[model samples]
Target: MDSDIFRHGGNTTCDIKQFTIITDKEMRNSMEYDVIIIGGGQAGLAMGFSLKQKNIHFVILDENEQTGMSWRKRYDSLHLFTPRSYSQLHGFHLKGDPNGFPEKNEIAAYLNAFKIKNDLPIIHQEKVIKLTQNEKQKFLVATPNKTHKAKQVVIATGAFYNPFVPNVHDGTANFEIHASQYRNPSQIPNGNVLIIGAGNTGVQIAAELSKTHQVTLSQSKPMKSIPQNIAGRSIFWWLETFRIGRAKPNSFIGKILREREPLIGNDYKTVQNNVEIVGRLSEIKEGKAYFNNGITKQVQNVIWATGYRNDYSWIQIDGVLSNQGRPLHSFGVTNVAGLYFIGLSWQRKRSSALIYGVSDDAKYIAQKIQQHEMK
Candidate 1:
């Protein structure tokens, strides 16, 4: 937590730390793989396993102490809307109670088992600091400990790596909070809470906190939300059966639905209508939120579910990223040779972001990698 590393706009400023390049002796001693996946999340592990099935050598690098560390660190009550069957990794199905959605801990355990069962090679506690391509087209992945080179690199870091919190007007000096810092409802102060962002995360947290605290949700735009169940079947079932969940993000219907739909979760109409819903918060001053409607409310806690920014600042490859910070890729193939990306939203279709649909994107990327290798 270096205070100087973060700029005034809440963006992180990078000061390159000293790194030790792997010497020839170290490279000879260390195991080299055909592919190096930088992340151990569901996508990373699944991609690694797929590569393994073809007997393609690959290694997974994770910053955490263990697999599924991201899920394990999330809030306790978090549960996947998609049932266990659809959420399982490649080559294996979840064996637990299929009727129920898996909790965060359950998913973490599943990932751990997936890694062990398939014997996927993973280096935990290694954070990738810099990723640059050498003149020879080998990926130079530098971690805090050492630098390793790989023929190909897969950026499987999930979308939620960075949490976005809009700046509070008075400065976030007093209210020590961010969406990433929130673990549970108990972490919120014991008073009325004003939550900005009516997306899934905001809606879920509002519903949970409504049980004990006075909660209000502020929305910048109307959201589309489906109930957990509809007509004796889970909403997810309908989405899967009709392939609504797999629709392309760029499709006319997808664009229309995404714009008109309200943010719905597992349960239908779980949020009480009586709960206050207001316009977006314009600013926060002296522990109160000022809304666009000129209304002011004093609150002890504010949860910003604004959204996330793609933070690939560590990637040193030029021309791989657009001005907007999103990777410039077609079907996960970046402009850089041997660098591929999967699990990104709208990478192929609208469903690419969903847990159940990520596998399709992963498979496509894997096929591309295979074709590139054959060349």
Candidate 2:
């Protein structure tokens, strides 16, 4: 990376005095740009594609070695909940079965193709470790080696960062894994498998594995599961028709959207096949799991498909995050000037964080930066 190839211009004279390497914001060499996007996922690509359309001088920095590693890292059996018709980014249609859900690798390939189609300038392996405002009022994107400067910044890092790996004592079950680690039914040790969290992922995985091994899905509360399609049309058609997917987070409809997540894609609820539905798992002890309904199961494998929490600890700015460590932003705009966030759940609407909604948020942000620069 050019950032790693520094100008041998800074103080290099050998001295008797010992000095620690300076990584302070004030000391690093900064590369200037109109905008800097921190992530390389769907959100970042969307924003980059939009900004490119506006002729904005910007760069998207991703930590991973590959542009689509985000999706490639997910469970093998996973596919998007939205059909191909509604799962596309702005520039290109997500290729595949238009009415069917795209597999995880398919989505990743689509994103990578989007990056290429839009000719986005994304620096892979440039993981942003810290972000702060420089004395010049520009945002500083700090990587391990160098700090890049930007007039405006977009935190397009997707919402799902830290996977919620659950800890339970099964007295050394054959094996235990989080849903993120699960690939197929064969990966689980030979025996009954207990899948936690009856949300979309848990339900779908359980249904798939049940065909081979005995599977039980346990959940505390019932999640809202909507049919993938109503009649012959896809559910997305209805969502767009009613504009329910575009509801604001603070709106009544948005509240329900955020809370329930409204499981879709699979018909696990109606026809569970070999899957067993159980009540909340209350305790894990003595090599057994006790349920709230007094049902006990001695399972060989436990799949914690619970969920994930967002961690923005690397960002060092006041007012950008609340005490709970959640970003405070309206749509993609943050309280800190020139700093914005994208791909957050309900960032602008119910679908803002999804593959399709990312385009709208990115376009809005691009427009905002253009107007700001024009002023």
Candidate 3:
């Protein structure tokens, strides 16, 4: 929470902000609460803010040992595509520049600071392994070490649950890593690096690595590049001006926007000369990666930035999730009583999963939990 931490980023020797982790002795076993929130990332914290306002008895169970582990584990040199103004939670604005993009560490630090400022009750390293309801309709939340009871449960785990890599690549590359594992260019050996998926993460990593290594970017679809700013204004401002960023998922404009996600920053443009952009990676056999366009290249290293999908198999409640392990919900409200979801992509609007946007869903879910208790 120190102001000095944000001042030092990118080639600087400053003490990086570290969060306090709750010790095991401090953790109470078999506790009861009005609500139990799964996942202590931004989504859970936002929900905490809402429940705290209502004086609701709740606790957040985080899998990580400390706060903001989700953002801290991201690849180094990662900057948010949305500016700081769009990358904040409810009642807490991110420190430093509002128009400038924040680095990954800065965001992580902010999350820790948010937790401290609000004094939210969080149980660190308590990963929820199972969630079900008892005969009396009360929810039972089980962790690796303890089982807690709650009247209601909110699954605040964000959309990025698991790293998804296509099975096209064989064990031919000398090294392979997912975007979650990538830290910096130093982690990669001196060889040609092939990055799969043309999402923002892929392009950003490719740009950073291109300066030191030969990087090839494989796109499953056509790359749609959008400038970070337009006429000295952040692109998010444009989206806000037209209300496109907050458009409802079922709306006509939202339907069109959801069809394809355009790259938000110009990182790719700066490294075009250093990196090679290729078509969809169809297959990789014997160290040779074949593209859909008939282009082939010999790659020694592979980095998969193919995005992520949510996993809801841990919830033992029937009809709460689909056969594909996807949560069955209508804007965070599930079919089952006292069970809800938040921080889902397009849960209510385009930014439902975003830091600033998730607050709306959190507040709505908190209200639903309050109503359930009254009934």
Q: Which candidate is the best by lDDT?
A: 3
Candidate 3 regions exceeding 4 Å error are 1-27
TM-score of 3: 0.92
Model 3 agreement with the true structure over 100-187: per-residue lDDT tens digits:
8998888889888877766778888788889988999999999877789999999988888988888887879999999989999999
CA RMSD of each candidate after superposition: 9.9, 10.3, 5.6
Q: What is the TM-score of each candidate against the true structure?
A: 0.87, 0.87, 0.92
Per-residue lDDT of model 1, residues 208-285, tens digit only: 877888888888876566666689677767877887776676777678756675565642255555368888789888
| lDDT tens readout by residue for model 2, 104-214 | 887777777666544567788888999988688888888998888888999988888887866655456667777888888778878888888988888888878877888
- Give the CA lDDT, 0 to 100, for residue 92 in model 2: 59
Candidate 1 ranges with C-alpha deviation above 4 Å:
1-31, 172-176, 257-262, 266-268
In candidate 2, stretches whose alpha carbon ends up further than 4 angstroms from where it belongs are 1-30, 166-171
**Whose lDDT is higher: candidate 1's or candidate 3's?**
3
lDDT of each: 0.73, 0.78, 0.84
